[model samples]
Target: MAEARSFLQRNRIHRALSRSNLLLGGDRELVLLTALAAAILIFVVLTVYSALLGISIWIGILGALRWMAKADPLMRQVYTRHINYRHHYAPTSSPWRRP
Candidate 1:
């Protein structure tokens, strides 16, 4: 009789690695960058109008990012990889053939 095996079952680490890492309902790095930029603008400018503008910009960016994330969590990575490929690639029959 063949022995049963659960050895290939997914574990906690696998789940963690597979999940999308989101921040403020959006991509982590992009949200952080937007926060940093907004903070800099708000503080460095030191004006009521500038502060309002900064907050507005930050809110707009966050809203847009959140909307995008809701649409697709892995869109950023997908788009980055997508841009590297051509619209169509011809098949190569042999290793020696020039691509």
Candidate 2:
């Protein structure tokens, strides 16, 4: 797996070479700040909705369970795919002991 990964890294040499070019200057920093602000805005909206729904332990528990049920199948599929891929390429231990 490590050997295969090294080959993938070698294929990305051109992408690595372009990292030195700072074409955005301060605009890059502004872009990052804008993205963060957008995330905070969405989070605040969700929080406001949740608060309006109710401030209660029962509501929180139900919301959590609902989200888990909604997300579980997709999460399970992703996890299974990752496990199968890893097992297919995982390195086997050598019989000889190393110092």
Candidate 3:
């Protein structure tokens, strides 16, 4: 059973690596969008059953925004602009700062 499990894990990793290579070799924008979508999907799915419905809903909303950004250039531009501005304006303090 352990051997079989290891084999399955290896196969999954191989397939994921191959798919990642294909995505990386193609259009960079598509790869970024795909990665964002996958991350949001995983977050929602993982949190759906936990006592974190609010967090899951927030992630789902962001995922919807990401999807819309993919369809609308203006949305993408606004989203990135705000993100850059936030990072620029925020102070870079110590890593272990308490609230």
lDDT by residue (tens digit), candidate 1, 1-99: 999977886646677678799998999988999999999999999999989999999999999999999999999888987777756555678768986
The clash count for each model shown is 0, 0, 0
TM agreement with the true structure for every prediction: 0.68, 0.23, 0.25
**Pairs that clash in candidate 3:** none
Q: Cα miss at 78, model 2 (Å)?
A: 47
Q: How close is candidate 3 to the true structure, as a TM-score?
A: 0.25
Best candidate, TM-score-wise?
1
TM-score of 2: 0.23
Candidate 1 at residue 69, lDDT? 94
lDDT of each: 0.89, 0.48, 0.54
Cα error, residue 56 of model 1, in Å, equals: 0.9
Name the runs in model 3 displaced over 4 angstroms: 1-51, 76-99
Residue pairs with colliding backbones in model 1 are none
lDDT of 2 by residue, 1-99 (tens): 555544343354577565422212322333345445555655576876644443353345445534644555244346669988985653647646463
Ranking of all predicted structures according to TM-score, beginning with the best and ending with the worst? 1, 3, 2
Candidate 2: residue 2 lDDT (0-100): 50
Candidate number that wins on TM-score, 1 or 2: 1
